[model samples]
Target chain A: MASRSMWRSLHYSAKRRVVSPAQYRCFSCSLRAQDQGKTDSEKMTHFGFTNVPESQKESLVGAVFSSVASSYDTMNDLMSLGIHRLWKDHFVRTLNPGSPLARRHNETEGQGWNILDIAGGTGDVAFRMLDHATNVNHDRQTRVTIADINPDMLAEGKKRSIATPYYNTGRLSFMEANAQTMPSIPDNSVDLYTVVFGIRNFTDKQAALNEAFRVLKPGGVFACMEFSKVNNDLFNAVYKRWSFSAIPLIGQVVAGDRDSYQYLVESIEKFPSQEEFRAMIHKAGFMIPGRGYEDLTGGIAAIHKGVKPLA
Target chain B: MGAVILARPGRSGVLSSLQKAATASSRTQCRQNHFHPPVQYRKQELPFRAAPTRSCRLYHSQFHPRAPTHEYTNSQTTILSAALEHIPSHGFTLEALTLGARDAGFLDVSVQLLPRGEFDLILFWLASRRGLLRAKVEENQFESLRSVSSVEAKTKLLILERLKMNQDIAHKWQDALALMSLPSNIPLSLSELHALSSDILTLAGDSAVDTAWYTNRLGVAAVYASAELVMTSQKPHADFAAIEAFVQRRFEDRTALAEKITGFKQYLGFVGSTAIGLGRSWGLKI
Candidate 1:
């Protein structure tokens, strides 16, 4: 009886709103508004009828980042519940981060290497990478340029960095940057480029790829962790319910902004599936020789990795 | 506002008559108002009060929608127009004829005509300059024949083939034009110029002809406007000598290209410097 009720709840929770194409457009516009940082232009784009301007994106993003930045590690713990950490861990594992071969061309030496993180909210990947990199070559110098178009997210990253031992080591810094027009970085300089939980937020994926490819060294590495398509029919059905029915309401209660969370749900649905995304990576000039999916409860979230050749 | 009947001093019949008279007059007035009232009339007769008009509603609603337009400089606009215009005119202007051979509908013919047409253009100019005025301009007309004759077959070639053609022609033009830039003391015939263009084009690195593979390369070329190669041997400005030596040494070392690009960037860190830096990094000799 409990299992049956659980399935029923999942179905209700993940039941799609069947958003009209018009609503989808409004949702997209609201997303664009969030990135552009416009508010009060209430001819507002609807993240689901909450009408927001393109200018409010920063503050809206800031709110989320501020709310979670301190607990970001906690939220990743609760939301994916502990799954996000494992996914990130898996991503690093696939990178072969400690291999002697990666260390040989360590042109970065004492001052270390450079990293460009796209939509890298709260500096999770940057912080995690710094932790792992230090273990690999303690004397090796490395810096992570953690950037997100969201100031709130960046602020959270900043706040969290101040408190972490990693931050005291002077290994990580935060900056506000659009995925499309990443600034202050030269071409072919970054050794590893990453985006975590942020790919679906971009308005133009190809432009983001072009920019990522632009800033990366010819043989740099690129990886991402995002919500992905679930593979098992039964689990997918349950996961869908959990996402749709409860996530927005949870947003309403927790973040006091149900609309933003609703936009999140819609965006995740619209994001390219895992295989389709692999092709995108390939198109972006990365040779994705290896790939793995966590298949978290039939694929609600996944980790993907792609690498630029080191020729 | 609805009309309100008022108490009046009169018998029931008189009251009814008065009410009827009032209704009759109001109906007539409403009819008059509906038809053609004076442009400006006194408002004393009307029982209902008027609402104030709102004018700001329209103006304050939203900002005027601006037309989205792609911004390109006049020079860029001119180049695009000139390139487009030349694509159909087989062999008139040097740039146009080359572009046309690539754009012309016949794939086989476009492929064949591109080299031949370019050769003819070079040959015709050479002959005219060398005073061999009798060798007819139309002497190599067969060069216009394409690899395929029909549009449907051309369509069947897929996007890959079209892309391949674009890359192939662009590479050919690159080499031929580079050689053409070489200070020529010897004037060759149309056939010889054609052969030389073909030979040089064939000799270029294989990756040069794959447009997909050459995204960075093409972007860099566009930045320099085809001056990248020429700039390698000759300095266009003050740092030309240093840049030439730096470029040559970097080319020899291969691995040092990244470091050299950074060096060039530092040297030329003026406004709009990224374009040049990006171009050099993409393996443009400059």
Candidate 2:
């Protein structure tokens, strides 16, 4: 039995590969300009602060992640002063991916808990979730799939996962997929769906939310953690100055890519406020109560969650 | 805005200042990761020590979730009303919508609600105002006008009422008219025109099933669109009396032309049927 278990672990790890961006096309081009029978110039969407053809947005965002893939984790630490780890920890705990509720549901369904972590490149959220599920809930059967649109980011995550015990235990995997549509992921399959600091990069956020609603089981949970609007004017002004002026300079010095970091900052500034985002989650047919989000650090970052109805 | 300028501060100085601000305002400092044994595991092991503040509101998970459709429409309405306030100064443009949403206490991302931005809001404003006009007509039981029996009189009254309704926005309507004339917005403008004409005919007690339905609606729509163009071409200081006179004259001219076309169509139908009857009697295929 021990030998069989070891063989199974190796087989699962061997199944993982870094998928290239070229191999991954957006599954549903419903909102593409060409699909709408319009010329590229006639229908434009925002690529960071610049307006570009809607079809070109995906590749532009992909190039950004590819350029910063290797140094991404270190840059994150330096940029946020390592406070990002605490936020990730809090996010995973709040999710409680394999807590008693998940276990109970898994028991009745006769399967291990499954989590689909979209755009979770570098395995930051995945590792934290695995640790929390294993250490806190004593649930070893919990599994996670880190899906990202960029292959270079996935390669970095794969390299980092080689030393972790979850690497070959059939507990972790990675896939190249777009948030707008994941055709390979079947309906009513996931126990939890999460996207950390990633949804704003999607060109069609409503379509992505609809896809999230489709892949989850009737009682699944949807959680998102991203930069949000700060309500206090004084703090907001200071934060804006710090973000717009300093972060890109740090990126230039540290990562040697100023434009990509500039794009990241612009994307954060363009994200919806906490309440508006909660309203969007509600629009996607999830069941959320009053003020269905929690703000962290005075709305600098927030965690919004909703549950799929059992019906 | 408090402009804080530091004289020739180095990169390290900026980083240090940011660090100091972060640490003083919040306990978000990084700590060493501690992986504990199973016996030492505790729910409170994480270093999330910040107390919940008033910046956010928390709700229990068990309460009923409200559908957001109503909220979405409410926000759009608020944004439209705010946009109207800026139209006089900036005209109908994306900048107006952006400033309007901000003035309505909405964040920058509120622009997402209107994917096409200014064009979408303009269409929304027109449709919403048309709805209000219909409501007003219904409330007065069609007695708000001087005469509802004759097509010319009725068209004149409807046009005058619409101009009156738009009196506050008269100066800005010229810009809106210009935007609606763009190639991309032409279809939307035409559809709104059709809807307005249909409403006016309905208030005149004209059933849409009549043979003259399409012709009547099209005629009225053209008259309305032209009258609007003429009204907007007037100087900003022009009185409503001039607009009312222009509308009456335009209505009289179009109404005569419409009556002539309707009579010609009836006469052609009579002659064509008579010809068909004669051809059938002569054993010819009709």
Q: Using Cα atoms with residue i matched to residue i, what is each candidate's TM-score against the true structure?
A: 0.41, 0.47
- Which model scores highest in lDDT? 2
Per-residue alpha-carbon lDDT of candidate 2 for residues B65-181, written as tens digits (9 for 90 to 100): 211111123445566678878776777776577567657754322443443456666676677677776777768755747455775577668867766766666667877877788
Each candidate: RMSD: 31.9, 29.0
Every model's DockQ: 0.01, 0.01
Model 1 lDDT per residue over B42-108, tens place:
2223211111111111110012221111122222222233344543333234445324322332111
In order, what are the TM-scores of chain A for the candidates? 0.73, 0.84
Weakest ten-residue segment in model 1 chain B by summed lDDT:
B52-61
iRMS of each prediction: 28.1, 16.9
CA shift of B256, model 1, Å = 65
Query: What is the overall TM-score of model 2 with all chains considered together?
Result: 0.47
Q: How many clashes in each structure?
A: 24, 0
